[model samples]
Target: MTLDEILDSLEHDIAVRDDGLFAGRAIIDGRCVDVIGVSRGAFVGVDEALWLSAQVMETIRRGGDTPILVIVDSGSQRMSRRDELLGLNECLAHLAKCLMLAGQCGHQTVGLLYGHTAAGAFIATALATRVLVALPGATPEVMDLPSMSRVTKLSIDLLEDMAKSTAVFAPGLVNLEKMGAVNATLDPAQPLAAQLARWFDVQPDRADVRDRLGESHGGRPVAARIAQRVYELARHVG
Candidate 1:
């Protein structure tokens, strides 16, 4: 879905201004929500990441404890010498930090992935949110199969076979959902407005719970345990 289609699917009154980045307000079930997003499936570069960070920080400064909805339809980070030289990684990390900070500051940060997003773009936006709500057609991937095959020095067929047995390294909604990356998938056929309203009423407060969900879904059985063990060790040392 296009950005407009996704917003329209909310079945709410929305007023937005866009300049590749979106900042708007929507009324869902009579509750006002602050909506922000990246448009055009952009290849997130340093400039885009920094711009997004500023927008989120400005929302934080507004201090309404307003619920935030981050809509995503983006490609991976820009793969170019210019971006790298300018510290793209730092900018993306800053963007993710800003979102996480918003959640910490009493804003209920939710993500809506209505279209394709991958790699750094996926991580710094949707994954940083407290709850990520995905639509049916959305695609989220850390790495595409072909790219993975190249990196791992395996044949595409072999990588495909491996992916059948492991959700840890593959791309697709099924794998990502199983790994607890997607909090929920909204049915486009249903009334999205109602479904989203329900989500707002019951969304989890924890900023990050993917590890626990990963364990429950059996997509990543040991991640939670390992994380806890590491946390305990670090705490003891501290």
Candidate 2:
């Protein structure tokens, strides 16, 4: 869906302006949300990352505990020598930190994935949100099959077969949800307004619990135990 379609689906009163980036306010179900994101599947780079983090900080300064809605429709980080020279990795990490900071400061940071996104762009945007909701037809690729094949030194065919058996490292909504990356999946056939409102009504506390979710879903059965052990050991040492 287009950005306009997404805003419309929320039954929101919003005014989104674009100057190579999208930022705006959306009032959904009488709840005001600050919306910021990229569009048209653009490749995120230093400038885009900085803009997003700045928007989050601006929202934080507003001092309302108002929810932040990060709408994502982007590709991976820019893969140019110039972007590398400009400290793209640090910029992306800053963006992610800003989102996490918003949540820590009492804002409900939610991510809406209505279009394609992958890699660092995905991490700095959607994955950083406290709760990530995937819209129908949203495509979130963790790693392209070819890239995964190259990285793991496994054939693309083998990866495909493995994906059928394990949600880990796969790139679909069902797989992502199973692995606890996606917190919710919006149903277009339902009243989107009510669905969103219901989510806020029963939203979980802003704590990182994906590891537990992964264990329960059997997508990552041992990760929670490993994390618990690591946390306990670190606490003991401290």
Candidate 3:
């Protein structure tokens, strides 16, 4: 579905600004949520990252226990020499921290993957949410398959064949679900507003469970083991 359609289904009285970030106060089944997202498939830059951070902070400052709904459609980070020179990574990190702080401040953070959710854009925004739901056919990937093949020195055909059997290196939302990246996938034909309301009302735990879910799904057993081992080592460290 288009961004506007999604927002209309889930929110009422939407207000969009000139900055490319759209937000509206949504009331779902008596639950109030602040829904915010970037539009026009905007390549997120340092400035956009800072804007997002400010939005999350301001939501917490408002002190309403309002849930934050993040709508992600970004394909990637902006490709600008100036952005990189001025510390793009640092800006993205700040955004991630602000999202985390919002959760710590008692807001239920949720993300809806509507369009291209890829690379640093996903990490800085949607990936930090407490619960993430992806629309059917939405592709969320670390990188495109050809790019991954080039980076890993693997043949494209070989990677494609492996992706058919395993989701660890695959790119679509279905594979992402198998790897326990997204909490759930929403059907486009179904009513998303009620589903979102239920998700908000349920109030899932904020703790990170991807590693455990991945292990249970048999998609990435080593991830949980490795994390546990690292935690054990850190516990003994001075």
Best by lDDT: 2
The per-candidate count of clashes, in order, stands at 0, 0, 0
**All candidates' lDDT scores?**
0.83, 0.84, 0.82
Instruction: Report the poorest 10 consecutive residues by lDDT, candidate 2.
Output: 11-20
Clashing pairs in 1: none
On residues 123-169, what C-alpha lDDT tens digit does candidate 2 reach at each position? 99999998888888899977888999999999999999998888885
Runs in model 3 lying further than 4 Å from the true structure: 202-206
- Model 2, residue 24: distance off in Å is 1.1
lDDT of 1: 0.83
* Model 3 lDDT per residue over 1-238, tens place: 8887887686476676676677668877678888878766777889899988888888989996799899888768886998999899999999888888888788888889988878888888888888789887677887888999989999999999998887887987877777778878888888888888767765546667888887787777788889888888999994
Question: What CA root-mean-square deviation does each model show from the true structure?
Answer: 2.2, 1.9, 1.9
What does the lDDT read for residue 227 in candidate 1?
93
Error of 2 at 32 (Å): 1.1
Q: Is candidate 1 or candidate 2 better by TM-score?
A: 2
The best-first sequence of candidates by TM-score reads 2, 3, 1
Q: Give, for candidate 3, the lowest lDDT window spanning 10 residues.
A: 198-207
Q: What value of lDDT does candidate 2 attain over all alpha carbons?
A: 0.84
User: Against the true structure, what is each candidate's TM-score?
Assistant: 0.91, 0.92, 0.91
